[model samples]
Target: MSSLPADISLDTLTPEAVAKTIDHALLRPDMTVDEVVEGCRLCARYKTASVCVRPCDVRVAAGELKGTGVAVGTVIGFPHGSSPASVKVCEALAAIDDGAEELDMVLNIGRLKSGRTGEVRSEISQVVRAAKERLPGCCVKVILECSLLTDDEKVAACRAAEDAGADYVKTSTGFSSGGATLADLRLMRASTDPATTRVKASGGIRTLDYLVECLQAGADRIGASATAAIVDDLRARKASAPSA
Candidate 1:
C-alpha cells in the first residue's frame, strides 16, 4: 500500500480512490471465460486494484488487463484451506508464473479451530514464501474467514498472518456463513501493524455505504463482485454533493 497524506478522509474519497481500493471478484466456479473477459474489462475501465479470479483464470485475466495498471489476482487455497502446505505453495508459484500480482490464500480453518496455530502459521508462511520467491513484488492476503471464528480467534489469525509475512489479512472467503463486517475489519486493523499488514474486507460488501464503512474501519481493500453498484453509487453521490 502506498502512503497517503495523513489528512485524507473517507468523506472526500473520489471514484478513483474507491476503485483503487477494490479487488473486483470474478471467482465464481460457474463463470465462463467470456464472463471473465467482461469482468476484467470492467476492472480495467474502473482502474481497480486488481481482478481477483480463480487460479486457472490468472493467465487470461493477466492478458486481458495487460498494461491497464490494474493487477491480476487469484486465490491460493480458496474457499477451503484444507489443501496441504505443498499444494498451496505450488498454487502460489503457478499463479505468479501465470502473471498474478496478488494472491489471497485461505487459512486452514479446521486447523485454526483445533488450536494448531503453528501449522496454520507455517502454511501461511510457506505460501507467502512461494509467492515472494516467484515474484518478489507479488502481494499476499491471508483470508481468515472471520465469520466462523470468535473475536479472540480473529485476533490470533491476524497475528499469525503478520508473523507469516503476509501483505494483508482479509476478513472472509465470501463462501462462509457470513461475510466481512465493520467490527471484524476494525479488529483486524487493530491487530496488525497497519504500515506492514493492511486490512482487506471481503464477502458481503456490496454497497457503497458498506464500502465506506469498511474504509472508515481501516480496510485498505474491498473484495466484491458488486463492483458496478458500488462505483455507480459513489459517482452519483459525488456528482450530487454540495460544492465546496
Candidate 2:
C-alpha cells in the first residue's frame, strides 16, 4: 500500500483525497445506460479513482470517463468466483478491450476453502497475465469474499493473490452476505506486503466515518455506491470545522 501522506489525518481529511480513495461503484444489475452515464459524470466530478461498472457497461463508462482522470474498471467473475480460469481470462481481456484500466476479479471461494490454494493462485495469475498482456499497467484486484472464509483462509487467499502478482487484495464483493469489517481489513493488511499489495475495503462502507475507519484499519482504496453521501459529509465537516 502507498503510505498515507505523513501530515494527513482524519481530522484534516480533504474531500478530494477522500474522493480519490473511492472507486465509485455502478455495478448494480438494474442500472440503465442513462444511470451509468450519470454515475460516470458524478465520478468525474468527484475525480474518483474509477467507476467500477459491469463488464457490459465498460464501453460506455470508458467513453464517458475518457480524459476525465477517472479510470474505467469492471468485474470479472463478479459476485461469485466460480468461473473457469480460461473464461475469467476471456472476460478480463474483453473488459480491457472495452477500455477498462482496472479489473476486480473474484477468486474461487470454494476452491480456496477446499484447500486448493495452488489452483486459486494459478487462476489469479492467469487473469493477471491476460490483463497486463492486453494493457500494460492494468491493475488487478483479487476479491477474497472474506465473509465466507475463516481467518486462515483469508490469509492464504491474500498470499495467493500476492504470489500471483495481483495489485490489491479486496475484502468483499458487496453483493455477498456480509461486508468489510475492521478485523478483516486489519488481517488482510497484515497478510500482504504493504509495499507490494494494497488492501481495498468494499461492501457496506456507506458513511464518511466508517470510510475513515477503514482507512485507519488499512484500506488503500474503497468501493462504494454511496460516493456522494460520503464526500458531501466530509465537505460538510470540513466546512463546519473552526478555521485554524
Candidate 3:
C-alpha cells in the first residue's frame, strides 16, 4: 500500500486530485457512439486523466476530447488476452492512429496458465513497441486480470509486463469474474519498479470509498464507468464537512 497520511480527510481530497487518479471507463459493449461522446464531455469537464474507450470509439473520443487536456485511450485484445501478437500489434497501431494516447491491453491468460511466459512477454512487447514507436508519449498498460491468477502467477505477470516495457500493470478487464482488489494492487505495486511502472485498478470499483482504498493500496490510476458519481460524492462530502 502507498504511504498515504494515516488521517487523510475529505478536506484534502480536491477535485483535481480525484480526477487525476481516474481513467473514465467507456468500454461497455452496448455503449452508443453518443454515449461515448457524452462520456468524453464528462471527462473534459472533470479534467480526468483519460477516457478509456472501446477501440472503435477511439476516433470519436479523441475528436470529442480534443484540447480538453484529458487523454484518449482504448483497450487492446479487450476482455480476452488470446489475440495473436501480430493482431495485438495491429490493434495498438490502429488505436494510436485513431488518436489514443494510452492503451490498456490484456495479457495472454491462456499462455500464462500454460506456463508459456515467454510468449506472453513477447506479445506484450510487440504491442508496447507498436504503441510507443508510433507515439513516443503513448503509454501501454498490461491488464493481468488478477482474479484468475494465483499470487505467484500475478507476480510473474507483473514482471513480464515490466520486462516487456509496459508503463503500467493493471488488474482486471471488468468482464472477468472479479475486478481489482486491494491485495492485488499492493502486490502489483511492490512487484514493479516504481520509477518505471505503475499500477492501475479497474472493475468493481464504483464508490468513492473503493477508489480511496485502491489509491492507498498503491494504485496510480483507476478505471471506472461511474466517474461522475464518485467525484460528485467526493465534492459533496468535502462541502458538507465542518470547517477545519
Candidate 4:
C-alpha cells in the first residue's frame, strides 16, 4: 500500500486489478427506476464492487441481488457531512432498515478542517457504533471529502475513521469541487499502522486508465458513474490482445 505523500504515477496500475475495483454507481436524484434496473443488472453481470443507490431502494436492491456478492449500499451525511452526528446515524438506521449491507457516509470535513479532532472522531464513532449495534456484520465506509482538506488533515481523518471503527476511509462525496487523487489515496494508505481501514476513491474517475491509477495508489474500492464504459473498454482491450 502507498503511504503519506500520495503522489503516485498512473503507470503503476494493472488492467486486471482495475476491472475488479469499481463500485457501479447511479445516485442521481432524477434517476428513473428503469435506469436503476439497468444499472443494477449491469453491475450484477460485471461483478463490480457494489451497486450504490438511494436509501429508499436498499430493500429492493438487496432482494434483487440476493446470493450475489454484490452489496446493497447507501449514503449517509451524503453530499454534505455537515449535519448533526445524530441525524446521520438516523439516516443510516433508515437505510439499514431497508436492507443496506454497506454504508458510504460523508464525514464532517468542515469540523476536521476547523481542527475539531475530537468532534470529528466522535461523529464517525457514532455512526460506526450505530451500524455495528443495529446492523451487525455490515460494513461502514466513511467518506472524507478530500478536496476540502490538506494532506496532513487527510491523514488525520483516516486515523479518526480507524479509531472510530469504520471499515473503510473513502475520498470525496462527488458533490465537492474536486474528486479523488493519487496523492490522497497514497497518503491515506501510509497513515495506517495496521491496514484495518481500506481506502475508497470516488468521483471523476471516468476512464479505465484513471481507475487503474486509483487502484495502484492503494484504493480497495472505487465509486464511479461510468462503470459500463470502463468494463466495455477492458473487454475490448482483452479481446484484441494476443492470447496468453
Per-candidate Cα lDDT values, in order, are 0.90, 0.94, 0.91, 0.82
- Using TM-score, give the best candidate's number: 2
Per-candidate TM-scores read 0.96, 0.98, 0.96, 0.90
Q: What would you estimate as the lDDT of candidate 4?
A: 0.82
Regions of candidate 1 where Cα sits further than 4 Å from its true position: 1-10
Task: Tell me the tens digit of each residue's lDDT in model 2 across 1-244.
Answer: 4535544566767888899999999988999999999999999999999999999999999999899999999999998999999999999999999899999999999999999999999999999998999999999999999989999999999999999999999999999899999999999999999889999999999999999889889999999999999999989988898998
**What are the runs in model 2 whose C-alpha is more than 4 Å off?**
1-3
Ten-residue region with minimum lDDT total, candidate 4: 2-11
Where's the lowest-lDDT run of ten residues in candidate 2? 1-10
What would you estimate as the lDDT of candidate 1? 0.90
Ranking by TM-score: 2, 1, 3, 4
As a whole number from 0 to 100, the lDDT of residue 222 in candidate 4 is: 90
Q: How close is candidate 3 to the true structure, as a TM-score?
A: 0.96
Which candidate order results from sorting by lDDT in descending order?
A: 2, 3, 1, 4
62-82 in candidate 4: lDDT tens per residue? 777778778889999888888
Best by lDDT: 2
Best of the two (3, 4) by TM-score:
3
Pairs that collide, model 2: 1-194
Assess the local accuracy of residue 29 in candidate 1 as a C-alpha lDDT between 0 and 100.
88
Give me the runs in candidate 4 sitting further than 4 Å from their true place: 1-19
